[model samples]
Target: MCKKVFILFAIFSFLLFSVVMGNWQVAPSSAEYEYSAGDSFTVALTLNGDGNDIDALGFDLTYPGSLLNFRRAYFEGTLLDSWMFKQTQLLSEGVLRIAGFTISGAINSGTAGKLINLVFEVKATASDEGYIFPNSFTDDLAGATGDTAIFRVKPLGYSVIGYIWYFSNHLPVPNVSISLANYLNTTSTSGEFSFDLIPEGDYVIKPEKINDIGGSVSPFDASYILRYAVGLTQLSPSQLIAGDVSGNGSVSPFDASYILQYSVGLIESFPVSRDWFFLPSEFPLDDANWNSAPDSISLSPLDSDTSGLDFKGIVMGDVTGNWNGGLKKQTAAFVSYRIEAPHQLSQTKIEIPLKLNFNQATLAWLVKVRYQAVGSKFLSAEVLGKSENCIFVSHEKNGIINLAFASPEPLGNQQIMVSLYFEKENSLSDKFPKIEICKARLNETLAQIINLRENDEFQASSFQLLQNYPNPFNPETLIEFSLKKQGYTTLQIYNTAGQLIKTLISGPMDAGNHQSLWDGRDEIGNLVASGIYFYKLKSAEFHLVKKMLLVR
Candidate 1:
């Protein structure tokens, strides 16, 4: 019985040792590769053993026929290197059959490595994911099959996505041109841009745009720039670049003047060569040398999808950074003030004073006036009581006039801001020329003019020459007067002998309140003896004289 048990054990051991276990697979169980159409790639077929040898192997390698084409297989340094017979053939559209055997003997159970290398050429545009799988592993000597190998080919390219925004408001900027490699795309309404099918390589992305240089460029921009130049305020790097309208590398009053000129339509274009400039969103805000920084984004050896590569747009003359990428929708506010000039067509000339009734002080104002009457033509305009530190500009196009004024300090109310003069032509029609205020702003805020007062009827009776104060006993006196019309006027002092003593005023004067000072002097700047003096005010339509006693 013991001998029988020993024989059975020996038989069992021989049978177990003779069993051949084979595991066939591709070298890389699963892989992903990128390739453009018409490109070529390779994969290896490999085998792993469970201490069992296989003399022959056969399998079918399947792939997407539309994306890949089968090429020659290589076995120079694989397990099938010394095989006596090796065969490979295309069984169908995308199915490849590979078979090999060695007549020398079965391959050593421990000898396991790559068997063959399968080559394929990309036939067309690849899908998102393409697979090359090995199936039906059968051999002349075999055991249990092992895990299958799957080779996945991904489309050969990455995506680049980004956005463009306005530097001031962070609003999306549309219609901007974005470039990567040799491809170009325009931004959508949402200010988003994207580029696809980009191969693996270093690339530079650039943005470009052409816009109106004068958009959103107003007197406020000039004021802001002036403040920055004088160290009264701060400016960002981009603002500094925009304030340099002359392209002179620095901000100055000259640039402010140029910008103001452009805003008022004095100049058609800015001195800067480019209307818009773009910078990467990641650009440093503290970079004082922003002008020297690269205006493009660089991707070195880009291999995957990249997004959020945003940019900021800067308009050249918009120092206040109010440009909305030329996409702004503006609605004028209600009228805050009105000046009425009710004159018959019989009058040859008319003057309209823009007087505000509000008591609020303002630092800036912009008024747009429309004179649409066919019988009247605008002659000229002037600002009354204008401060020395203030900047004022007026532009006239067709029958419209734009008046922009900015002051470093707030101007008091109840003052005449501007006076418009017009010349009326003789016409038989009784229609009065319409002088309307189309728009008005007070320091960037809309103001309303509730009443339109007719000054023509009240103007003639309003002229007056007031009595001098502290008269009869002073070396100096103040004389006040009011004019109903704008014309060449004169104020003179004379002695009782009727000889002219001194002329205090002699020039074209606006129709408003005026004052003059007489220091008891003669025409040659000599002090006169204490005596009686006559002061006279004369204009085109009015004349008056008053007497005062000068005492020493």
Candidate 2:
């Protein structure tokens, strides 16, 4: 009887080991398929066990969150009804109807491998598009846990090209990566890449990831691809040599000398000139009409020189205001001057009734004041209610003196007016301390303009081949590096065969550091035969090589 019991115990131990060891394994181990835009692909999941009854195997998969253009999905099986899309919370299998059949559902437990399947509709976006499938199991094992699987749906027929531009004098941010899905192309340190050609369509271009610094990545870095037209054509010299800015067929000095008479006060207009009716000097200078007149000092024509500037307003605005254009002798004579348009204001003047409140404010009594927005196009100011006044002052193209009100504390229900006094050839410091009063209402103005100089200040460098993380990597590891500039770069893996085994990136990189997850797989996704693999980085100016090991 004791011998019989020992044999039964051994049999039970063997069965238990088998169930644990063979608990879960995905079929194909890895899947590879190419799809065009608006196309579909199929993937299967099979079980390996001694009749491990699985009522349901649910999956919660996410694409490269920023990459895939998620549309709809479906699954197959008796548990197809159990598949729920968490975001929309809709049953994926039911709503996904393509062709004569709904391509997604669950399989019957009896059918086993025959029942578990999925269909995905591909989007015609751009190169390097893909999706990841993560799965979970729901079975009679009760307390058992399941592992997830990842599957990729690659795009077909597309090429990817990377663009990189890095300039110094800007913030030196290197190590950036640009990825294109359909072409399966990623940029390295060189900032150059070529992808497989695919169908043309709009691609969502965004900085996939940002540098370690808190600075935001550039959105303008994104771009769309335009496919080739049916055919191409060339233009003749007459058609090509248009726009006679310098006129010779091409317009140049001869045309300008001939048209100089039209300039200045000599003639009303010129024949060759198409648009000049909007000149500022042509109109009687007034603060209200400033936005309409084109001037030499503004950004439109982008004048680098400003010599003689002057403006005489009959009456500046809703408030009684005046100025003599020059900065040395500025003037401000107003109970108040209110800004209009761009936005609206309720006050036009500041009335000083009775004695002024000197406890919390400083008032200035002036003969006159002027406002000007000279050599610039924006108006931003902070006004003071009581103490701490910070105002932006500038000279205007029309010779008006502009004042931007600024203050530290909030001005509630107070309408305060800043008055400036201008006298002939008189400097601001030489003017009288004007007695200014107000009902303290702070109107703050801030403009969001492109600081080209600042924008150009922070330039990214190319992606670099940093030392691989976990250097003597086992079967898995990570590679990291920074791109100090922009341009084409490459990260290639070479086996002992001296042949290129895999390409981690072969494209343009933005300036910043980036990391790639490498599993020591060859180009064919086969576990590279255990040995040594060298990764090389080649860019326009940088060449680096690093060695890594693969242990079986």
Candidate 3:
């Protein structure tokens, strides 16, 4: 019901926007040409928009009827190809009205598309300022069930300016020779050059300098390409700036040096996916966004180039430019954790493996862990390795724990970010630490995360017994527990009626975490029946009992 209401509200909002804001638009904004009287041209009208659904539309267009003649309307490739009701009639000498609809119930959507082609014949000489105006338009259907959005009426007018510029040193290249159809001129000091007062025609402009080989204009190749040129040390001022090697705007000796490295095969070029951009690290900027156009390529020291996940589940660092904090960003999608054998009813230490998909050096990060336990008390946590000093108390609530840790410096040079260690005290039998990410700021505000396994490594903090892994033993199973002090311990199994079934251990045990094995057999070497059973650990001062299952 709520979903239905939300959908209704959405439809209502769309209708409101269409009725109030009117987002429909027309494209090409402007065009230009010099035509003699009687010359005719075709102007394709494209319906531009922000993708609102609409079935019917009507608009009033005002043009200079004396200067141009509007031929019969064409809808060969328009949304109104099968208009239920179509009208294209002149309301007055200079005003034309248009109305169209889709009886098949199609709606206009997407960026924009051709709606119609207007064939205009120059009736007589007309000023270049003549235009087509979407004076007013009504966007609606028969009822309010449809959607409409705010739209801007775009006007197409005549244009007559033509120019292009080349840039250098973050400024326009001045005095550069440019030519078109044997017409020649040098750019102004401001780096701008243009053609003006010319009759209407399409033209291509070219910039030229003394003969120089042209190759891919990429930073990764510029250095080598320039190095292989005839004169290694001397290039024309134009050639020097043309390389734009560093892309810092001006030509510099460093550009030549970079080329030499590439030419010698000392460095290689690579490509990155287009959907990435870089901003300063001082403030956390945009989220992960990628483009396909590709960004500039450059060379870097080989040592800082390793990143991604490794065999041990540790996150490798992103050494590339911190695109979306790739260097420090963690891939939350593949992120997961594992638990080693715990201390068995004692203090357990959880190892949080930090994994990554990329890294160049040590990646710095901060993580807030929120964890809760049913049979354990939340205890202190340690930031593994050199990053241990970065841990600080953040927050805590109920039985859950939150810990914050940051690196004093970037950590990926060694390839793996440090691991995290968490301790839980007085945990119940077989209870593993339950942890989650409250917050993770990789590279300050850019990064991924660590995976925490359900069963993790732990150190026994008190005398306690833990449930056995692979229980319901067929042949045998291991029962692990812990002791705080050295003592004589007895481990016995019994059936439902409290009858002794088997004794696995009846001797001295070490004062630390330990384990025992149990096979599904009674003292007489007879197979036990498939049923419920209980295991009890008894010492002079401590005793605990837990249930288990047996199968024949």
Identify the leading candidate in terms of TM-score. 1
Kindly list the per-residue Cα lDDT of model 1 for residues 1-552, writing each as its tens digit.
Answer: 999999999999877756644343344444555566777877776666555666777877777776778888888988788889988989998788888888786677656688788788876764444567677666743343434344345556888999988888997888888888788999987889998888879999998888644358888889998888789999888888778788878888998899878877898777877777888889775547865655689999787789989998888888888776543234333334557554442457766666654446777888767666657777777788887898888887767788888889876675555777767775554444555554566776555434354555323346789777457756566676778878999999999999999999999987755556676777644578888889999988888999999999
Of candidate 2, the 10-residue stretch with the lowest lDDT total is 220-229
Clashes of each: 6, 109, 57
Ranking by lDDT: 1, 3, 2
- Could you give the candidate ranking by TM-score, starting with the highest? 1, 3, 2
Q: What is the lDDT of residue 384 in candidate 3?
A: 40
TM-score of each: 0.51, 0.21, 0.26
Which residue runs does candidate 1 get wrong by more than 4 Å? 2-16, 19-139, 144-150, 261-272, 287-294, 325-332, 335-552
What is the per-residue lDDT of model 3 for residues 1-552, given as tens digits with 9 covering 90 to 100?
999999999999988866644455664324443455667766665676544676777776666676777876787777677767777888887677778877675554554666666676667643434555555666652222222212121112222222222211122334445554556765554435554433344444444332111222334445433453545554333343334344454444455565455456665421211111221112222222211111121113211212210010000011111112111222422222333343332246544444322233334444444455645555455434544555444345654344444456654434333344445454335555554443344453433333343332334469889765445656555566778888999999999999999898999876765666566777754567888889999998899999887766
Question: Which lDDT value does model 2 have at 172?
Answer: 18
For every candidate, C-alpha RMSD to the true structure in Å: 23.2, 31.8, 29.3
**Candidate 1 similarity to native, TM-score:** 0.51
Pick by TM-score: 2 or 3, better one? 3
Model 2 gets an lDDT of 0.38
Instruction: Give me the overall lDDT of model 3.
Output: 0.49
